[model samples]
Target chain A: MIAILNAYRYRMLIPVNRTTRVLAGLTAALLLALVWAAASGALGISLWEVLRGQEDPFSVQVWWQLRLPRLLLGVAVGAMLAGSGAAMQGLFRNPLADPTLLGLASGAGLFVALWIVFFQDSGAGSLYGQFAAGFLGALCVCLIVFGIAKRQGGGSAAVMTLLLAGLAINTLAGAGGGVLAFIASDEQLRQLSLWGMGTLTNALWRTTALALVLIAAALWLLMRSARELDLLQLGEATAHAAGLDASRLKHRVVVATSLGVGLCVALTGVIGFLGLLVPHCLRLWLGPSHRLLLPASMLGGALLLVVADTLARTIAAPAEIPVGLLTSLLGGPYFLYLLMRRNRAC
Target chain B: MLTLHQAGLTNTPAIAPLDGTIRPGELLAIVGPNGAGKSTLLSMLSGFRSAEQGELHLDGKPLRAWPITELANRRALVAQQELPGFDWQTNELLSLGSNPSKSLVAALLDDLDITHLAKRSVLSLSGGERQRVMIARGACQLLSRCSPTAKEGGILLLDEPTSALDIGQQQRLMRQLRSWATQHHMAIVCVLHDLNLASTYADRVWLLHQGQRIDHGLPNQVLNPATIAKIYAAELQRIEGGTHGKPLLALAP
Candidate 1:
C-alpha cells in the first residue's frame, strides 16, 4: 500500500507540485515509523527508565546489554547498507549495484574460515579472533576491488566491473568457506555454520555505539555528495554541466560507500538487498531526486531490517534463525518484483 | 554579462568544438548540425564543462571563477530533451523554474497560458505547451535576480526551443520572447534548428559546423542560402527572403 502511494507520489507523468506534496507525506510517515520501531525495542527497558527517571536494575541490564545495543546496531546496519546501495546505483547508473564492492563479505568469510580452522577447538581468544579475521578480510577485499576497478575506469567505469569483481571474489570465498565446513569436525562445523549465517545475537553496547559513529559519519558524507548523484543519472557529461565535478563525486561516493559497506560486512557476514530494496522502492514512489530518495531509502531500509531482526529472534522460541537468511528470503522476492516491473517499463 | 572569445571546449568523442560569445541583454541563436557541438558549447558557457581553451566570462569574471550560487543566480540553462512531456502538473513543473518564488507555481503556470491545464497531468499537454513550460522554468531562474532594472543580471541558455511547438504556438512564444527578452534585457543564448524563426526574432546568430564557428553575425549574414546549402549538405531555394534580406530555405529536392 505504501509503495503504491509512493508510486503515485513519484509519478513524473503527473506534475511535480503534487508529487512533491505526496513525497513529503510519505517521507514523514517513513521517518515516524523508523523512530517508532527503534524506540519500541527499548520501550520499557532500563535505558528508557533511566532517561525517564525510573531506576530498575533488571530493565537497565536488559536495555543496555541486549535491546539498546541491538537497536543501535540494527538501525546503523540497515541505513548504511541501504544508503550505500542507493549511492552506488546513482554513481554507476545501474540499480543492481550493492555494498559488496568492498569485498568485505568475502574477506570476512575467508577470515572466519581461517579462524575456525586455527582456533575453533580453542576456548580462549574467540571474540577477538572473529573480529580481527572479519575486519582484515573485508579490508583486503576492498583494496583488491579498488585495484581492479582502477584498471577498468579508475573512478568511472560501468558498474558491471564492480559487480563482476564482487561476484568472482564472493564465489571464491563462498567456495573456500564450504570446503572448510565440509572438512571440519561435527561440533566445530555446526558452530561455524551457525555463526556464518549471521546474527546480531552477541550485541554489545560498545560495538553498537561504535557502529553508530561509523554509520552516521558515512551517512553525512553520502548526503554531501548527493547533489552530484542527481547529476549522475543524466550521464557523466550532463552531470558535469549541472555544475557537478563527476570524477571528484565518484571518488567520494566509492570511498564513503565502501566505509558503510565495510562496517556492515564486518558486523554481519553477508546480507543482501537492504540497499537494493530501499532505494528502488523510494525512486518509484518519490521520483529520482537524491534529497528525498536517500533519506526515504534509509528510513524504509532500516525499518524493514529491524522488523526482520525481530522476527529472527521471536520465530523459533529463542532458537534463533540468522537474520541474514530471513532478509534474503524476503528481500529476494522484493528484488524480483522490482526487476519484473522495471523490465516491463523498459 | 557573459562573454566567450575563441572558446573551444572538448569532451570525449567530438561533442564540443564550437566558438562564440554571449553578452548581457542580447539574444544569440546557435544553429548547426546534430553533432555540431551546440550542447557542448552551451554546457561550457553555463559552467558545466570546462573549456579546454578560450576565455568565458560572467559579469567580466571568468566563468570558472564565479561561485556556484552566483553562477546559478545569473545564468539558467535548459538543455535539449532534458525534460520531456507533455505531462507533469503544468504548475508543478513550473515550480522548478525558480526556487525562491516557487510558491507562486500556480501563477507562473497561468502566465504560461496553461492555467486551465494546471490540474491536468504534464503528459497531457501538447508539445508546444511543454516547450513553453521549459521557457517558463528558465524564466524562474531569471526572476531570482530581482534587480530593479531586470537587465542588471540575467542569462537564459535554451536548446531547441521551437522544435516541439506547432507554428501558432511558435509565434505566440516568439512574440512573448521579444517583450520578455527586452523587458529583462536577458542574455538569451539558444540553439535553434529553424532558420526562419531565427531570422524573425534573434538579434544575433552563431553558425557552427563540424565543431567550428563557420559564421557569426546578424541573422541575415548567418542564414544565407549558399551557407545553408554548404552546412546542411542540402539545396535550399530562395523565395520570400526574411527580415534584413536573409534567405529562407525550404529544402529543394
Candidate 2:
C-alpha cells in the first residue's frame, strides 16, 4: 500500500517533490530577505563592499553591532512563533489553532507588562528577568487550559473546551495588562506600550543568543513529534489504539509552545499573526503533512519577518514602526479571507 | 484470544459483568438494544477503558499488562463514525501506523470492496465508502504487524460495521468478515443492530438489554422469536428455515 501510494504521490508530484521544492524555495527566499534586511538600514552598509573588505569601519560596526543581531533575532523569533503555531494546530487538530489566538502570547505579554510596571527600576528589568516573567505567565495559562480540558475528558469536546478557555484567558490577560498600564508612570508606560506593540529594537547579542538556544531546543522537540501528531489527526481514541501516547504528546506540545512562544514575546513583545499566517499559507500550498509543514513554516516565517522588519525600520527611516503592527495589519485581512474560504468550502 | 472474566464498567449506562472467551476462527456478534452497553463493552474489550469491576485477559496475560505497541499489533478496533482530520488518501490512511505491504493493503481493500478508493481522499468519500476504508485500515493494522509464527491472526473488533452500508454492501461486508475470521484464523467481534444480520452471519450471538447480557449461544437458539420479541419489547416475527436453519427476524407491521 505504501509503495503504491508513494508511486501515486510521485506521479501527482504532491508529497516528495513538492516538499523539496517548497522548502528549497523558502530557504532561497529567506537568504535573500536576510541580505536585503542587513544592507537596507539607515547607515546603508554595502554587504558586497564588506565582503570584498572595502567598506568603511563605521559601516561595518553598524552592520555588526546593530543590523546583524536584529536580523538574527528576527529570524529566530519568527521561526519560533510560526513553528509553535503549526505544532499547536497539529496538537489541537484544528487548522485555525495558533499561539496568539490561544492566549500564550498575551499571557506572556501580561507578565512583561507587570515587570515593566513593578520592577524595571529595581534591577529586575534584565533580559533574564523579562524571560522568567514571560515564561511563568505562559506556563500558568498553559496549565489552566490543559487542566480544564482534562476535566472535560477527551474528544472533540475537550478541544472545544480548550479553545474557549483560551478565549477567556486572552480577555483576562488583556484586562490585566490594561490595569498595569493605567498604573504605570509615564516613562514606564512608554516602555510598556512599546514592548506590548512588539519590536526587535532591544536586539542585542546576549539576548538574541539566549532566544536562539531556547527557540532551537523547543523547535527540535516539536519537530520530533511530527509522526505522533499525524496519528493524532485520526482523533485521540483511534490514535491511542494505533499506539500513540497522546497525553505525552500533549505535554510535549504544551511545554514546547510555552517556552518557545514565551521567549519570543519576552524578547520581541507580542508579534501577532505571523504564527497564524505563515503555517496556514504553507498548509494550503503543501497539504497538511507536518513532516514538511513544520520545517517549511520555520523558513517561511523567517523570510516574512526579515522582510517585514526591513520595511518597518526603513519605511519611515530613523522613525520605526513596530514590526508587530505591520504583521497584524497584514495578517488581519488574510485571516478574514481564510475564514470566508473555509465557510465556502463547508 | 480474549477472555473476559466478570469484566465490566461501573459508570452510568454501565455494563454488567461478562465472562466469556472469544476464540479464533469464530465471528461473535454482540446484538443489543439502545443504551444496552454494546459500545461500552467493546471499549473495555479493546482496553481503551479498563474493566472497573473485573479483568480482561489477552493470551492469558492481563490486557493492561501488554505493551501498548504489542497490544496494538494484536488487536485493531474500527470505531463508528470516524472522520479523518485531514485529507489523507485512502491508502495513506491504511498505512498510518502499521506499514502494511502493497499486496496486503491491496488484498484488504479488495476484500472490503474499496480498491477503487485507494487513491481518493478519505474526506471526499461517501459515508459507506469511508466506513469500508476505515475497516480496511483496521485489518491492515493487524495483518501488517502479526508475527509470522503466531497461531492466530490478531483480533479485529468493529463497532457497527454496517451502519452506513447499503443492503448489498452490508451482505458483502458480513461475508468478508466471516472469510477473514476463518481464512486468517482471526477472532472477530462486531456490535450489530440488525438481528437478522447477526443471525445470518454470526457463529454465535450475544443478546444485551439495559446493560445486561440476557442470553448467548448459537444464533439459531439465542435468536428465538419469542425471546427476542420480549427482550426487545417489540413485535418481531421470525422466519424459520433460514440458511443452515438460522432464525431470521423481521419487524411486525
Task: Give the winner by lDDT.
Answer: 2
TM value for model 2: 0.92
Q: Is the docking of candidate 1 incorrect, acceptable, medium or high quality?
A: incorrect
TM-score against native, each model: 0.76, 0.92
lDDT of 1 by residue, A1-346 (tens): 9999889876844656754665556556656554554444423333345567685777666655777577667778888778877887776566666665335566677776778776654655665566566656766776677677657752324455787788788888888988888888888787676657767765687566766786799888998977667655544443343345666786687667666665666566677777877887777666666766777677667777777887676677447778888888877888678669857965
Q: Mind giving the per-residue lDDT tens digits that candidate 2 earns over A1-346?
A: 9999999877656535766777878888999889888889777789999878799998887787788999999999999899988888887677777888778899999988887788766553466888988888888887877677668865666766777877898899999988998998999888887778889988988788888998899989999988888888777767777788888999898888899888999988999988899998888787677888899998988898999999999999988999999999999899789779877986
In model 2, pairs of residues that clash are A1-B102
The residue-level lDDT of candidate 1 at A162 comes to 80
lDDT of 1: 0.69
* Model 2 chain A lDDT-worst window of ten: A118-127
The ten-residue window of minimal lDDT in model 1 chain A covers: A38-47
- Candidate 2: stretches off by over 4 Å: A1-18, A120-125, A147-164
